[model samples]
Target: MRNRRPVGIWLTTVLLSSGTLLLSALLAGFLAVVSFRHGWVRTSPLYGIIAFLLVSAIIGTLLSAFFSKKVLNPLIALIKATQQVAEGNFDVRLEPRSKGEVGELIRNFNRMAEELSHTEMLRSDFVNNISHEIRTPVAAIENCATLLISGQLSGAEQREYAEMIADGARRLSTLSRNVLSLSRLENQGIITERRRFRLDEQIRQAVVLLEPKWAEKRLELDIELSEVTYEGNPELMIQVWINLLENAIKFSNAGGPLIVRLSEAGGEALTTIEDRGVGMPEEVVGRIFEKFYQGNPSRAAEGNGLGLALVKRIVELSGGRVGVESRPGEGSRFSVSLPMENC
Candidate 1:
């Protein structure tokens, strides 16, 4: 009842096979007339020839159906599986028999479905994390506002309430900015415009910018560099360093040490930032690069959970890669590799 052909190759085979049989029968009849009727035994090979033609036609039709069905069976299965996938079933899989184009098609479809499933999971997780992140700060601000409105606070208490409000606002601002940065980094329209810059200088600038934050915690700084110059956007790479360092300072125990190292390893410029903090578990570290992923979701850290995600995206955009090594209670070390080119 679907407004399309039932199957294409089936019809083609039927038509071609039937036409071949009819043409062969006519040729045979003509040859019989030339050899038997005009030259030799004219008694009649007519009934015998008629029987042969009928049998040949039958065999040709059967063979055509047999060959055509072999192909049509897999084709129909593929079509049905695609329809199911379109109807929101990512679990449907096609098992094609032979290793043909059709088999490759099915394999690719399975992969696409798997990827879609993973992406959907990530999207759902992101939505939930974002909702929780927003709710906590908003609820805190609302509670503080409610206390002030109910006249339950003295002058000093009111000042404290105002400071709480300011703090919530700052957290929200940080969340919004990180979200925007992550979005921009993920946008396909944003491609890297590589240029030459000193990798050591970039790290120094990021450290300088974040010095006040780390200094307030009395965190000791360690630096080692090979004076590496690389081709990349210095500003974007600076953001990567800042985010990693800021995270280190935020999560590190007070007076702990932070190490920032830049060096050339195996023809690549590598920057590593290691912190002595409450590190992540191995399981969490496996998916650390995923967007909106937070190893600690207790809302303890002042982040929107996009910093590492942004760092990974920016590194990939610059023809580089990012990786993390961490274990719970020990610490985390994040490394990024970029091309070591003079441009």
Candidate 2:
């Protein structure tokens, strides 16, 4: 496994050499025939041979230079760019100048570099967000503990500080559990623990579970569900409904409308959760499902940003797809579609 010469250079040299030899032989034969017809070869055979050798040498050198420029230069540039990428320089890109396969290769390499750069940016954002999320709760808990340790407060003050500490601890616990769940779901490729369950009942249960929040806001509920039994992991599917409903409850304006609907058509089940909330712009709607992507800065403190990402991953594992629609002032509508057949 020793390093060999570059294939482009080697192949180009071989082809050029073969072509020069064949062309030179044919030219020399033609020159000899013409010279014999003019009686020149008989008188000056040595001079003629010298001239023919010089001409062949000059033509071969020129052809070698031309072919090398045409073929090997792009390959050399591509090799250097590849080395840069291997060294973690995802910004490197090559200009596509050739046709056919070489052009396609350059285009694909450029696209790969762009994608890698985007992924790197996302990774950096994830690290920063997680650090902020963890640090805020930790700082709160530390402050509350310091206040409690002072032992200079009244009973009511002590209880308040203890409650603050508990709340911070609960936030930390929830963040940790969500991170673990999202990590597990991201790595999972398929849904298991399948069972036949009433999809409508599951949605209803999820709504009931979040009653406190929507009740506090006094939001109107518009529920329309058809009896549809779905075969999938009940535990995971329930999570999807809970997360979606929670999101709707979290963002809805006070006394606004919250709509939940489940129906079946064309051998597929469609469930949509719509909320009259402070909706997102086009850009935020597009990236809302990405891990740790919280588009609404004003409401970022309510939860860690892994809920929607987990919901998306679980739905996909169950052989379904999810989508969302929203406008700036209008509310958002999240739709999940699942195949009726067992998967």
Candidate with the greatest lDDT versus the true structure:
2
Off by over 4 Å in 2: 1-40, 151-153, 187-189, 211-224, 253-259, 274-287, 319-333
TM-score of each: 0.78, 0.80
User: Which lDDT tens digits does candidate 2 get at residues 1-343?
Assistant: 3333478676877788778867885677678668977886685655675677678868876887777777777787787787788778999999999888888889998999999999898788878888999998899889988988999889999999899888989999988888888878877778777899999999999999999999999999999999999999898899999999999988889999999999999889999999988889998988888887889887787888889998999989888899999987789999999999962
Predicted structure with the largest TM-score when compared to the true one: 2
Model 1 TM: 0.78
Tell me the deviation in Å of residue 228 in model 1. Answer: 5.3
Total colliding residue pairs, candidate 1:
0
* Cα error, candidate 2, residue 140 (Å): 1.8
Candidate 1 runs further than 4 Å off: 1-17, 20-24, 27-46, 141-169, 187-198, 223-230, 263-270, 299-301, 321-330
